[model samples]
Structures are given as C-alpha cells and as structure tokens.
Target: MAVEVVSGIVLGSREYGERGMVVQLYTRELGRVGVMSYAGRGNDGAKLSPFLRVLSTVRVALRLGRHAEGMPKLVDVEEWERGAQRGWSCEKMVVGCFIGELIQRLLEERVPNEDFYLFLLERLGLFAAETQDEVVFLMVFLLDLAKSLGYAPQGEYTVSNRYFDVAHGAFCGRGEGEGADVIAGADAAVWGRLLDGHYLADLHDVDGSQRCRVLYQELRYLEVHSGLRLSLRSLEVLKELVG
Candidate 1:
C-alpha cells in the first residue's frame, strides 16, 4: 500500500486491546479517520500518546487500509504544534472535550470537508490560545458548526420578524406556533449576531448569563434538527463555570 501523509488533530481515542488502541482524527486531507495504533508497546508508543491527546495537531504517515473499508494503521506521527499540557483550565478542557465529541458524532468516517477541517483547526487553535471566554467561544463554535452542517437558521432578523423558529430554521413573527424551539426575540438577535460571523472579541461585551442562554438555545436547536441527544456532560461543567 502507498503511504499517505496528512495533517490532522486528534479527536479522541479508545483502547482496543491490551497494547493497541483506536484513535480518531480529523485530517486536513481525509476528514475524520479511525486508525489503530499500538500505544502500549514500543518506544514509539510513548511518543504517540501525547500527540494523540484530544485536540493535539500532528502530521502523520499512514498505511492505508488494504480493503478500502478496513481500518488504517498509524505508521508515524509528528507534533504540528505544542502548548502547555496542564495549563488548560477545567472549563477549557471540558469545552474541548465537548467539541471533540461533537465532531466525532456528527462527521462520517473518511469523509473529507476541507472547509470544516480548517474551521476546526482555527477553533482548536483559539481554544489552545486561551485568551477568549470559553463559553462564548463554544457558543460561536456550535453556531458555526450548524452552518457547516447545513441546518443553520436562515433569514435576517427584522423589527417585525424577530423570533427564531428553531424547528423551521428561520426568523418569524411572534406567536409562531409556540413550540419549545422558538427562541425569544432577544435570544434570537443574539443567534443572528453569531450566525453573521461576529468574533468573540467583538461580542465580549455581552453578559455571560446571556451568552449561556444563547448557548442553551443553540444546543436545543441542534438537538431538534439533528435528532441526536447530544452528550451534555462537558456542558454541565461549562454551565457551572459560567454561572
């Protein structure tokens, strides 16, 4: 098999056997891939562990699956960037874990999306930088991820039509069906600002409580649209932090 080289960020991993493990990575060239690595066995094992940590970016050489649908084997890995291993706060780590889990759940294996890949890279870098509000960043990331996945809310907010209909993915007038997905005008405006691509720095003036509300609404939107019960363990930690 021909060796393929790709740059990727580790999403998550699980121990497969006593010595081997399955690592999930979102690659620049191949999107999300699951490869088997022996991380408990040789000298390379020690080196691979750190590089495979969640959100760690690396360049790797892979031995492609022989049957095309089989699992690929990890040949080697090189760290692309390094940051403080233990410097991340509890909030940051939880948010990072949530993002990783969300990506792993939403994307299909071996399906490549270059734009989404780049977006993930940038967001991960921002998280690593640790200069922004983690909760606010997470809310923005969820909105952006929804846009990438094609379920982002549509239509511009106007004075007359300000309510965001999460079920319909659009702005509508008040008294719009009274579903649990309909966000209030204030919250709808916040979602609009985020969907319009406002940076976290620009939104820094927004109160943390409002940000948390917007995030909850966005997560509900995702749940309604994607039909997946998202894992909220990390989100619980974030809620406590923000409050």
Candidate 2:
C-alpha cells in the first residue's frame, strides 16, 4: 500500500504481543488510528516509544497492514514537535490525559475530520501555555468537542427554566424532569453559556464546588450524548490542582 503521512499526538497504548504494542493516536488527517510497533530497540518502531510517550507530537508515514484490514504499520516517523509536552505542569498533564481519553473514546476510527483535529490541537497548545484556567479550559474543551461531535445541548438557561437535561441536550424548568443526572441552578446556567460558546470572565470566578458541578455536568452531557463512559482517573487529582 502507499504511504500516507499524518501528524498527531499519541493517545494511549496497550501491550500487544510479547514484544509489540498497538499505539493509538488522534491525528490531523486520519482521526484516530493505531500503528503496530514490534520492532526491536533502536529500530524505527521502537524509536517511537519515547517520542510517542507522554503526549509528545509526531508526524508519521503509515501504510495499510497485511494482517489487519484497516490497521496500519509505522514506516517512517519524525518528532513533529516537542518541549511543550515536557513543559506542561503535573496538573496540565492530567488535563492532557483527560483530553486524550476523551478524544480516544469519542472519536470513531479511521474517519477524518480536519476541523475537529485542528480544534483539538489548538486547545492542547492553549493548555500548555495557559494557566489558572484549567477548569474553564476543560469546560470549554467539553463544549467545543460536544459541538464538534454533534452532542452539544440546545436552549438557553432562564429563571423559569432552572434545569439542563443531559439526555435531551436542553434546558428545562423544575418538575420538568430535573430528575437525576440533570444540571440545575447556577451550574445549569454556566453549562448553558458554555454550550452557547460564551466564555465570560465570570466563569473564572466560580468557586470550586460550582466549578466542579459545571464541569461534571458538562461531562455527563457529553458522555450521555456520545454513549461513552470514562473512568476519569485523573479527575480528582486535576480538581485538587486547579482548586
């Protein structure tokens, strides 16, 4: 097969055969793809372990594999960019992990959407250099990703409509099924603005609990619409860091 060059960040990996790995990436062109690496140390595939490790960026040439119909094999690769990943604070790393996990779980395989890819790449760039906005950053990411992936909730929050429903992707009034898993009150308001693409400065002032509530509500909305579940292992650590 012909070589196709793509640029992206390593999402995560799992051990394959005894000496192999299936490394997944969210790419600018290919969306989400996995490349097989069984080459011994010092070889092309093995060289990727370090570069692909820890959220580093890479540009790689991949060709369709013989064994799998769609999976590709790593041919030639180069570090597309560096230093930014190393410079991210421990907290930012957790955010990065959350972003990576979200990207991996939400994106379908092989399909490509350059707009979503660039949007993701740009956000990672912001998270690297920007600080004190981590929670809002995650909130914005969830909003953007939701919209980009068609999970964005509709409607505005108002005094009468005090609840935002996740499954329905819209705001509703009390007794209108504010039931379990719904975002209510100020949290709902904030999420409503987030879904509307409004990033008011006041968003930065919301206290930890409100911040947590809005964040989790947006997350549930995203997950519910996407039908994806996340372990979110880094979430508590991330919350502590941001707070």
Candidate 3:
C-alpha cells in the first residue's frame, strides 16, 4: 500500500472493538475519509487520543488502500503545534461541533474542496481567539458555506425590492406568496447587509434579536437550496449560548 501524509481535522469518532476507534476526518487532500486507529491502554493510546478529539487539527500518516474494502488505515498521528492546545469555552465547543456536523452532512466523500478546507481552518482560528461576536461569525460562515455550495442567496438588493425570496434565493419586490420563505421588511434588510460582506465588527449597531433573526433566515435559505433538513442537534445549545 502507498503511504501518504496529510493534514486533517477530526469531525467525529466512535469506539470500535475494545482498543480501536473509527474516526471521521475532513482532510485537506482527501475531503472526507474514515480511518481506523488502534489506541489501546498505554502510551500509544495517549498519543493518538488527541487526534480523535472533535475539531482537533493533526498531521497523519495514512496507509492507503489497506482494508480489503479500500478503507485507509491510520499509521500515525501528530497534533499540530500551532494553536492546538487553546481551550475553548462551552459555547465555542458546541458551535464547533455544529460546524463539523454541517460539513459532514453537506459534503461528499473523498471529493477534495481545498478552499472549503482552508475556510474551516481560518474559522477554527477565529473561534480559538474567541474575540469576535460568535453569533455573527456563525451567520457569516453559513453564508460563505452556502456560496461554496453554489446556492447562496442573490446579493441584488434595492430599496424597492427588499424582500428576500428564500425559495428562489434572490431579492424580490413585495408580492403575493410572501410567507415564511420570503424574508421581507427589516429582516430582509439585515440579511442583505450580511450578504453584502458586512462582518461582525461592522454590525455593531445591530442588536442581538435582529442578528438572531438574520441567522434564522440564512439557515432557512440554506435548507431550501440544499434540500437537507439541517435540524442540527447543537442548534438549541448554540442559540442559548449566543443569547
């Protein structure tokens, strides 16, 4: 088998047998992959434990095509030193898990999207810093993710046509069928600002309730486009944390 070294972030993990684990990783070179690792009770287990932590970044040596069914085997793992040990607050942890789950659900297996991988890395850094408005950060990240998936809401906003048609993923004028999917009025205006590249710092004047409303609209837009019920488990936790 050919051995390859790659950088990845742990998306999730589960125990296998008595001394091994099956881990889901989002790799820079291989999009998403499942690898098996043996980490029994000893120094070896201690060394590999960090790699199983959700959102932990690591350099791993994978024995490609090791399994008869063609699953990769994890030969070795080393946690990257840069910002590796920064402790995340409870809120950050929940948000990070939510992001990981979203990626795992939305992406296909073994399809490399380097831009999205780099975007995750950048957002991880920002989360580690823990200095920005977390709610706004998440909203922006979701918008960017939607764009990467090729179904982001249209950024064309006019004073007259301020209603965001979520089902169509565009801004529209006041008309019939302006119900849940049609974000109109003040909510539409805020959503437009987010799509126009206004970051958290630029949105200081906006209050928390309005930010939450925009976030909900953005999520609804994504659900409409992707056709996936992203009823994320950590969503309630995130909402409580942000509020």
Candidate 4:
C-alpha cells in the first residue's frame, strides 16, 4: 500500500552527485522529511534547492516478515511555486537563507503546525515582495514568532521603571519609590512597542546605539525564552553598512 500527499516546500538538496542528491524538506503534512532522488539533475538540480516550492507524491513500502527499514519513497515530483524565485527581491539571498535556516532549526520535526506552516508560507511571499521596510519586517516577524512559541513577554511596565528582566521575559514594574530590578524607561518603551507590533522605525529619534541595545536585549530575551540562537547575519550586515 502507498500514500500520497501534497506538502509545502521548505528547504532541500544543494549538492551534485552521480545519481541525484539527498535533500531535506519541511512539509506541512509530513513535518521534516529527507529525500533521495536521481530526477533532479542539471536543470532539475537547480530547481531542487532550498525553498524551491514543490509538490511530491510519495509511495511508502512496508517490509513485513523481514527485519528492514521503512521510509516513504518519492514516486512523483512537481513544481509548486515555480515562478516564486526572482533575483534577490528582499534582502540579500544570503539573508533569506539565514532566516530559513533559523526557522528550520527552531521548528520541531513531524509536529502538526498547519497554522505555522501557512504563516511561514505567507511570510515568504511577503519577504519576496521587497517593498516593505526590512528592519521593521524582521522585528515584526520576531515578535510574532516569539509569541507563537510561548514567549509572549510580560507586559508589566511603569513610567518610573528602568530595566527589563531578560530571564523572566517581562517588563519589571516600578516598586515603591524605586525602579524595578530589570527593565525601565526606554527599554520599557521598546518592549511595549514590540508587544503592540509597532515598528522600530518610528523610534529614529533615539540614537542608533540605543536601538542596537534594545535589539540585543530582545535577542537575549528570545534566547532565554526559546532556547534558540539566531545567527543575526542581517543585523551584522546592517552594522557594517552603517559603520
């Protein structure tokens, strides 16, 4: 018996070989899957790259009465979003790859998150558009993703406070005649804006160093809350350009 399914293409093969190649894909239905194929070669090989959306109909063979391994086999492959690839429409292609790698690492394998898959698919579409502000775009993506992954920051804040508690993932409240132990003032303002899905672009009145500090603070919050470290290559690129 065999089963067939349509899955969203996440990432896959990027190697040259005799037969074909080994690729990894994050499918909406099957989660993370590995495929070995001889079909994608030359022109086909180029199309089989990471995030080259494709439709795969696979056949699963079960070994009975014998000690053997079982994995689904690809019976047919079809291009899904064939025209989605343009040059580098958004940030550099490398930055996009970095984002994809982060997603691939953070997401668990074989877990059902149809909503997340769809959200990611839409994000890819938006990233491809390249019309929006990339800095704001990344911050929005981070905040939304953080909330989804159970890292919604504690909103407790006050005008008199001064530091954000990274480990607690919250804005520390002002105490009696004193600021909170962690976050306060400008950091509180930034955190409040992030929680509200507001873009940081509006805060240009603040010094760039202050902005970078807030970004670093958020990064620490994400690390403590999600146990994932983003490569932040895009941030580095921005820093180099500014310097």
lDDT of 4 by residue, 134-206 (tens): 5555556676767766677765556644446666676555553232335567766766766676433465555
Q: Provide the overall lDDT of each model, using Cα atoms, as 2-decimal numbers.
A: 0.57, 0.54, 0.54, 0.47
TM-score of each: 0.62, 0.61, 0.61, 0.54
Q: What TM-score, to 2 decimals, does candidate 3 have? A: 0.61
Candidate 3 lDDT tens digits, 2-120: 11122234333354222222223334454433333322233222234334433353332222224465544333223322245355443444455456555555642323255655665
Clashing pairs in 3: none
- lDDT, candidate 1, residue 199? 46
- After superposing candidate 1, which stretches have Cα over 4 Å from the reference? 1-86, 108-112
- Clashing residue pairs found in predicted model 4: 161-184, 162-183, 162-184, 163-182, 163-183, 163-184, 164-182, 164-183
In candidate 3, position 72 carries an lDDT of 42
Model 2: per-residue Cα lDDT over 1-243, one tens digit each = 212122244333343212222223334453433443323222223234433333233332223222255423333223333343444444444455456555655553323355665565665556556555566778877888788777667778888887887878878888776468877877877776666553333475578777776777777776677776665333544444455
Give me the candidate number with maximum lDDT.
Answer: 1
Name the regions of candidate 2 deviating beyond 4 angstroms: 1-82, 85-87, 108-112, 196-200
Model 4 stretches with alpha carbons more than 4 Å out: 1-95, 108-112, 156-162, 175-181, 198-201, 231-243
Measured with C-alpha atoms, the lDDT of residue 13 in candidate 4 is: 44
Which runs of model 3 end up more than 4 angstroms from their true locations?
Answer: 1-87, 108-112
Clashes of 3: 0
